[model samples]
Target: MKLKTEVEPRIDADERGYGGVCRNNLARSRGETHFYGRCGPSRRFFACSAIMLLATGLAFAARPSRPSPLPNFVLVVADGLRPDELGTRAVPTPALDQLAAQGIRFTQAYAGAPVDAASRAAIMTGQHTGHGRVRSELQVPLAPEDVTLAEVLRSVGYRSAAVGIWGLGWEGTTGLPTAQGFNEFLGCLDLVHGRDDQPAFLWRNEVPFVLKGNPGPAAAASAFEWMLRGATNFIRINEDHPFFLYFAPHLPGSSSELGAVRIPTASPFTNQTWTPSQRIRATRIAYLDEQVGKLVADLRKRNLDSETLVIVTSTASSDAANEMTEASKPRATPLSESNLRVPLIAWWPGKIAGGRTNNRPVAAWDIVPTLAQLANAPLPKQLDGRSFSALLLSQPPPTNSTRFYWEGHAGGLSQAGRIGQWKGVRALGKPSVAVYDLEVDPTESHDLAPTRRDLVAQFEALFAENSRTWSPPADGAVGAAGRPGYPIPTNVITQPLRTNSPPDGPATP
Candidate 1:
């Protein structure tokens, strides 16, 4: 038997977004001839094939090119990080500063709550504390039915992972990352464990791995390093696919004591003239900056930098009392600018224009919708946040409403609302409300409420409406006291890898 073959032309879009031609083989087993016009000779056949190839190339050139792949999201939430504390003259955060220079920095970013757990819940659910399931650090567990950013992204083929501090709930709880949406969960789940450096146990998906170490200041640094390794590994493993990596590092927060703070002893700030507490806090912040640099460098090394959207923000502002001298401490009431205003930096090379600063007030809840938009995922209708993804692209941000509301019940029923330049605060058991013109009094020293009753009334009404609109769930207290030890079955833990199916999606492969 004789074999016959013809060159088939294939054209595709090259990296330059232009058409390129290549040859493929079209073969037949037996001697079969197909011709057009007169019976074609070998030279005529070659000529006809070349003409057809040219036409195919022209057709491909006229067709529209495929769109770029969805960008990967890396949300790095630094616990208790204040905007002033970052890239400041006192403590230079070169990594964060570089990120701010490369991306738009929201100078007026506010957390949904003034505390950790509620703020993180709001961030994940895209709802403010008024509407979120959890409103306090350890009072309410995130309801299983609540939709999380990970669940939304996972539904659209994104592999979601949570590394580091997840204060939503403990292992085996409905609020656990595995139950919520993450395909993988490697970190502390309980709020108490998150606050400590040497946690008794940390969760790897549904399984808990007991950590063996002395509970010293160095242990916190070591724990942060361990979490960083997990984050980098997840990024490496999911480089080829769209992924959402929630990298929440617990750092710079005061240790169990008032004077004791955990930071690497070898921190460069050891020689500083500041008090030990100040040096320790500054060192912790610098250490976080260094880790961020590492993550960005790794992405660049893997050629994934341009395709990744890296966001750096905080759960809440740092405790100023810990880092500031007694004489220099600003009078920051609960839910004041000092406690609410945190830094938000979004970096995507060539996609987001660099060196831009936005002062428009944005809340942490907005992070969810913004990321959902970037990932090409459907935004959940129940979300209280509007996507600021347009703002990152240098477009005018959506102007649905300029007013934002927040209320904290941990200390007391303290309510705060900001409408454009005016900010109002009403604390429970206080006779009068406090209002400030943030444009002039960013420190919130002067109370404009006494002078500007009109603005105060407007803000008070807004807060009241928000409070009435969303009340805390009746069963919210379930699992409030988080489980401290490992909760995984022995058989499951001993296996190679164990994963539970998320409420809204299948187990991550």
Candidate 2:
């Protein structure tokens, strides 16, 4: 599984006209693509080439005419949502269905990892589990050097806000949403506190805002409703300028008691003949749908419908034992396809064509680059994601050269990789591998690894190429209950302030 390297030929910067500025790394300077290490015969030829190269560079870097304003982005991340339950009889989701009817829906979308924190870290940092900072579900804050999607948007004159579960960091830590790049943040700051549907207090930026009469019948409202209100308020305040809102709601999650649903009530499904868990699941789905509908209606009311792009997707797979009702099929675990696949929908009015279903295999890591491309921002150097903005406009996207990689770090190290139609999975501490052809057998009910030796060798090399060594911190990080233990030295200096000023820098056309 060793890799081979080749040395590239060197050339003079002046000869290549490397002084000309290029907007992004995807575009190269004039005469740099084909003139890597070559030389012309005479001085006359070199003079002619420099003039041509300078003219070509200016043309390539020219701005577009009749440029449009920057579009707004709304990302909705849900927990414990299954892809198969969208159009089923168990739950009615008119709002989500309407959203799918207005934009493109991805059929073969997969999560970055099997757990919550790992999967979210991949999405925020534009790196998969192999190279991301937070690989497992541990309560680790994002290191100071880790850049997020919101930070990328902020660089392009776009204000950013977040509500609901913020799992990457908590209060007084570098992983806090405000410390990362969010202008305003409100909701649960840790995974342990996120489970309670009605907590006594939730973090507003860095301080606690107590919920009146929570954990009792006299409670004013559920945490879910409060998050929804906060999201809408942010949108209204920033309607005059470009913005990015991250709304992550914990819905239809597993309860503290085994085999039950985590919800406040079951009013919508009270008269049904289903089990108590089924009733609670249905009610939770209904509430989530209503909130989505309200968000869309608010955008239309403010005349911002055509200027915003709303993306609705799940964070990870549902818990089969507790979250899944009688409608869903048997779920899988430990890097199985069922555990990684989830729903992905994008809605943009008068921008993207509607009623189209895409089958391109996209993972959670692709989110950061996609938003950066849409905002016309510069991408970082160490990213593993390829942007799919062309796919949204009904055009072929940039071809991805690397295979998709995922790993689970809960019990022990497990690995999985996918290339074209072939998919491979290796269990924890097992020597054997299971391969499946996703084109013919999407369910992966049958195994073909016993007969495909060539594929096995390919996977072995792919796994070796994608993996990187990770070392966990000893102590002085955030504890399990969202308490700050001690401060670790890093490069970032963050100020958690509340202001309405727009992001610095003029908007790029």
Candidate 3:
């Protein structure tokens, strides 16, 4: 759709600040009309004035009414950010806070899983880990047939671009964003390479290009800046068109296997009295926030602020055990409430009401349907997510599923099902289930399974049903095994060293 344009004649104004018939090409094209002082009378001038007014009115009447332009979309997914760390006194994420203030903040938002790939898969395909094609990190690539958010938006005439760490695909794989409906893809393909703080090369679409920089302690910062530049450029180029930008920034998450975490030497927190790991994590968070602020500012400067929907969320929560101060740490003991719950902020000036907070439960899979609804795009027939656009607009919540399901085998095979206030988790090879009342105990600390036999049975039944419907790929599949559940300790450390593998048997719970 074409943008609306208004034509106004520039005229000299009197001391009262009122303007007279301005001279411009618009007027000249109609006819050579002469005017005297404002409101001055002359038979010829009066005739001309009446004709001009009539012509202008007719022109306006003749022009067909254009529909409102579809708003552009910017989906910014931070690597591993917890809800509490965002906009809190300790973390100081001003950019994210400003976004929350400008739009709606979902108090109970969750990732599909407490890991990267599965959560991202849910976000992209609008399906939970059970229904989504890719259930694990790097284990199963997104099949070409799977309908993605980009594909939906592209079908509706939106130009789509993806930047940063795309965990769905690797080099020479069909899972690349370009193949998955993004018009352009600029960043690392695999999660491991993406985790690299100082990678020698990054992929631009299907082609790989070596970066020109000295590999050192500042590599991670440099890589992040590169991705940000690509994102901004995509926005600048597609400013006039309805575009979809999937900007995934790999920050805060450690890529230590490649080298030391690249903490910006000039970070504001560098001089603070914190541990080395804490400082590094803080620097990354601060840097990521700064980039987000810059991107938002750029949108406003380009006059696209009102015509764009900017969402800031994370794939998963942070993995660091003691990253924050003791007082700021979450009280919840279960991974369901702690690691899975993420910060979700949607910002669109004038379109979405500001300073609104939504306490409704939402999951990462919900993003796909939400974006589809906003863009007026068609969704796949089989989808696990329902549009939460209503929540963003302060309207009544959509007819959505109340129960959210998650499954993983990273550390150990485990499944969790949350139905309203109650959450039940069962590990593979475990006979009993652990249950919690999230409403009363925000943390999944108090397991009500032993006392509440009925609740445990209900959760167990729910988990079994969900698993039957959306089981991960069979053992020894082409892709990596789906890592679900919470962040647990693992024996083998993968590159980037982000997630914790589950142990051999049932967990402590």
Candidate 4:
């Protein structure tokens, strides 16, 4: 469908008006994305404003309604999911695979950081950690001065709401979602506060929802129910305005909350004292998936599905659950495709071209910049991730530029950098370096590190470059009390991201 380029219909009257419209059209032919180069937002905003206003006012001489404007943007980021887990191919997820059939399926998408805080920061700030924002927690955050995805969207006419888990800078005060750009925030603050049995205090904007103890499954369910209801209601109230709904569900680990459901003497879970009620954990995942299903269904029920762009991904893997070191057993880090890669399905019906798969490497950091481009919002100055917006239309990203990078793990051992088919890693900040040609080895089984010394060297150089440039946030940058350790801060950028578990691969047939 031909997209509506103009904001509104205009009555052709004067020559100057037509000329202004033509000039704006020429400028617009360039692309709608607002940029932050050497010239700051002031120039960018003026340029964007002049274009939007001119298009809205005198650009349209005829009443030819173009294709519908952007659908309501709904980004769903599920936690702790591996890419292969999604049954999207020969064996597909009836629901998520259905999503792939109805939208674009990204095979090689990765989180900015293996952990939540930095990943979320990258998503919000549209910059790389080297810029010094990814490592900060609630108390020490991405900095209040930083402009976020919410702030950028809010500047536009988009009504926004964030529910589920929001990890980065999740302080009750300035770090809360509200301060970052969301209009309505109904979520908890810390990482481990909320539970199925004893509910954590839910924060509404900055205020915690006054509650007695033990809100239980019902309350958790209620909060989720309220999330869908609130966003649907918001859409109904402001259907004229485009809106963004960010839902990051926090499901219980195989142990954590699930363990509380039953007293375990010696559970199989690696966590010392913490063991997930495996049964409970599985049940809860199913429950959360169903919640996601419900949310999507509700949008359709409200006649808002086709007009919405739904994006689902994880903020990042849980900290405790993801502590896999040689010294530590398989604590489970989802940063690898087996663990870290989350589900990413964008549903925009006719606009997004359903049933197409783009396996090019992409990152969570790209989401903010992409959204800003789509919304015609002005982009922030610092951005590490590039917008793969073209993929939404089945187009290609810039050649030789689909690599992704991340910094995570206890000792920042869980590092990630990808270029084309090649991937580099140094898990848990170890001396071990592994390399794989993802084109051949999606499941990083064989060690190519020794053989491909040149590729490894290239990747190592890249890693060093990113470290210095992106500044992978640490105790130092985020203002922590203790100085972070690099124990062996050798400059080897190209190495395998070491996994705590046995090498990650598909369940052996």
- Output the number of the lDDT-best candidate: 2
Summarize candidate 4's per-residue lDDT along 175-280 as a digit string, tens digits.
6776676766656545444323244345555544433322444322244443444444444433445778877656533344343542111223334342233334
Q: How many clashing pairs does model 2 include?
A: 0
Model 2 misplaced regions, further than 4 Å: 1-68, 256-266, 318-331, 476-509
Question: Residue 236's C-alpha lDDT in candidate 2?
Answer: 58
Better of 1 and 4 by TM-score: 1
Per-prediction TM-score, please? Answer: 0.78, 0.78, 0.77, 0.69
Worst 10 residues of 4 by lDDT: 31-40
lDDT of 3 by residue, 1-509 (tens): 11122222322222221224435543333322211122223467668778998988744432232254788999999887777777766668888888998899999999887678877888888877666676655446777677788888877778788888888865456677877878777677767667665656666666555544525556333566666666675665456568889999786674232234564446677677877767777777887898799789878767788889999888776354346543265543334677788889999999899998988899888898899898888888768887899888878776655788887666556788888778888866676799888888876678888799998888878877776444555643344323332122232122221011112111111
Cand. 2 Cα-lDDT: 0.70
Instruction: Judge candidate 4 at residue 130 and give its lDDT.
Output: 51
List runs of model 3 lying over 4 Å from the truth: 1-68, 217-221, 255-265, 325-334, 399-401, 469-509
lDDT of 2 by residue, 1-509 (tens): 01111222221222222223332222222222111121223466558668988978744332222144888999888776767768666688899988998899999888888888877788888899889877777767876688888778877767777888888986666899977777677788887677677666666666565555565452344777667666776675466668899888876554322244334444576788876766766677777777788889878877788889998887777353335443455546658777788789999998889999998888888888898988898787778888878888778767764389987776678889998888988878887778889889976878898899898888888787888887556753444345443221132223221222222211111
Candidate 1 lDDT over 1-509, as tens digits, reads 01111222211112211112211222111111110001112565667668988988744332232254888999999887878777678788898899989998998899889877888888899988777777765546566678899888876777778988888766456787867777677777776566656554556765655544425445432556557666776665456667789998786664323345454446687778987777777777888898899889878867788889999988776355435433277555668778888779999999899999998889988988888887777777667887899989988778776779888775567788888888888876675678888899987788877679899789878887787444445653534345545344453333222122112221222
RMSD to native, candidate 1: 13.6
lDDT for model 4, on a 0 to 1 scale?
A: 0.55
Q: If the candidates were sorted by their lDDT against the true structure, best first, what order would they fall in?
A: 2, 1, 3, 4
Candidate 3 versus truth, CA RMSD in Å, comes to 14.9
Enumerate clash totals for all models, in the order shown.
Answer: 0, 0, 8, 32
